[model samples]
Target: MITRSVQTVQTNPDDIIDIRQKIAGSWQEILSQAVTNPQELLDILGLDQALLPGAVVGSQQFQLQVPHTYIARIRKGDPNDPLLRQVLPIGEEMVITPGFSFDPLGEKPKNSHRGILHKYQGRLLLMPTQLCGVNCRFCFRRHFPYEENTLNREEWLSAFDYIRSDTSVTEVILSGGDPLALNDNRLAWVVEELAKIPHLRRLRIHTRFPVVIPQRITKELLNWLTGTRLQPVMVIHCNHPDEVDADVADAMKLLRDHGVQLLNQSALLKGVNDDADVLIELSERLFSCGVMPYYLHLLDKVQGAAHFEVDEQRARQIMSGMSDQCSGYLIPRLARENAGASGKVVIAPLYSLKI
Candidate 1:
């Protein structure tokens, strides 16, 4: 197997619980202290030996990344837990499916601007950082050439100037490798620069930081978030209700309290949140936590995550069933981003304006 050796986690009981106590105060320290090792995650959860080798192999291709706050929610010893399934790297990831490719959404061709991606008209995606708080196993951008896109001070200034010249671009989206992974000062600087552009009407941030590491919702992060002149919108991602514990809810609520419009998008993953019941629960939970359901994304056909994809027919069925049980606002649009498409095509059947 083409894999690098992972440092073993010292499973002595004190060391296990000690890190948890130490990470209590600061989200910066918590992010700095995310658990990247597969064995350390397994040891903490008390998982069995049967799952180890596959996890080790998969981690090499896309390293296992889950913050302690997110891990604490998983039910110990249950391999099928929704949260675990999303983060755990299993043997199935090694298979190269016929249809799946490195650039599933055709993003490589859309690299028209430095550190900027123009997929849909009127909006551009700015990737200030190629880092994330938690590296989700099924992420479509798993193979993204982020290293090449890492823009320095002058490059970013050039990119910002590029945005200023594009009169048609009205929305600036901050995506990543989860954009919120950047420190408050760094993100603030970018926001301040972007706010000067007169054409931009909205500053949309697509992130998973608040959910994975609730402590990431610090006051310094909020200062720029609220201070920005552009209309601030946050698109958070969460696959299952279990992922939204009390801490996650509080973090989201902090954003809500600060006037950041909260919206959520989730990928429809097999064995994770495919069930109608699960979808319904997730929607209701999301609404209670101050987020409106935005998109139920059909899995982006990317390599290593074909196992997680649910077919279009089945996806529609699940959405239909969810519509029957959930309130209209809670029912997210079932959307797919076909390569080279102008926008996400909504295919969720029987979806009407009326609840």
Candidate 2:
């Protein structure tokens, strides 16, 4: 069983504020403040040996990195831990493969405008920031050229101009390392600029901060999100249900109360949340907190993440098991992203054939 630290609270949103204020000065800051070096992060979590092994002193040392906020949420000394599986780097495979180029998804080639990726029609993904609270081991964009993609003030203006130029593009997705990592002032500024584009209908933010650092969902952040003219959508990256705690649930409630749609996109990792029961429980917990389970993505064929890949057959079986137990809404669509494909390819169940 996955063990977690629990806290109780009343239904009132003010009560949530009271809880946060009480812990504001004392509470640990994970990504933005506490964690600095990769090795020191390991010592804090007491995961130096289990994850690193003999490679600790070698030229290529395997490191155990977890944000203090994330570490605070974990039940200590559980090897089967899901959250640990995401951040702890194990010495498994090091050799690089041919097809796993820096730009596996062809993001750079498809960029029509600076700070914008126009892969799909009717929408443009604007990489507002190139920083995330915590870096996932299986990130497909681990090697993405962030230096080339960072947008300056004039560059952002040009991106907005491109959005206004094309009426077909109705949605603007604010993504990056994590959009919420930006302070309220910067986030509000970007939103204000996007609001001027008359053609944009929906504004979506893809972030992992709410799951990793729940304290980031401040009242000021919610005010800007709801105050916008375009419909606001937040897609949170959460691989395991254990990552969602009372703090995270409170954050989601704040957004839901102020008319922001909440959705989750989970990645299927071999040792992390590949089990059927874990996936089912994740869906149930997400629904209870008003966040819809959207997609269970297969691990992208990234070079460093080859250790996290489960075979295609095993993945399909897990999906089938989930379908039998949960409602269709709770069961997320199982899919994979093929390089240069028009859209995400859904993985269908296998059928037996006899000749």
Candidate number with greatest lDDT: 1
Clashes of 2: 1
lDDT against the true structure, per candidate, is 0.87, 0.77
Question: Model 1: number of clashes?
Answer: 0
Q: What lDDT score goes with residue 77 in model 2? A: 60
The weakest ten consecutive residues by lDDT in model 2 span 54-63
**What are the runs in model 1 whose C-alpha is more than 4 Å off?**
1-23, 351-354
lDDT of 2 by residue, 20-39 (tens): 74685322344546554546
Q: Which stretches of model 2 miss by more than 4 angstroms?
A: 1-15, 24-30, 48-50, 53-65, 349-355
Reference-based lDDT, residue 43, model 2: 62
Q: Per-residue lDDT for 253-312 in model 1, tens only?
A: 778878999999999999999998998898888899899999999999999999999998
Q: Could you report the Cα RMSD, in angstroms, for every candidate shown?
A: 10.2, 5.8
Residue 23, candidate 2: C-alpha displacement in angstroms? 0.5
Maximum-TM-score candidate:
1
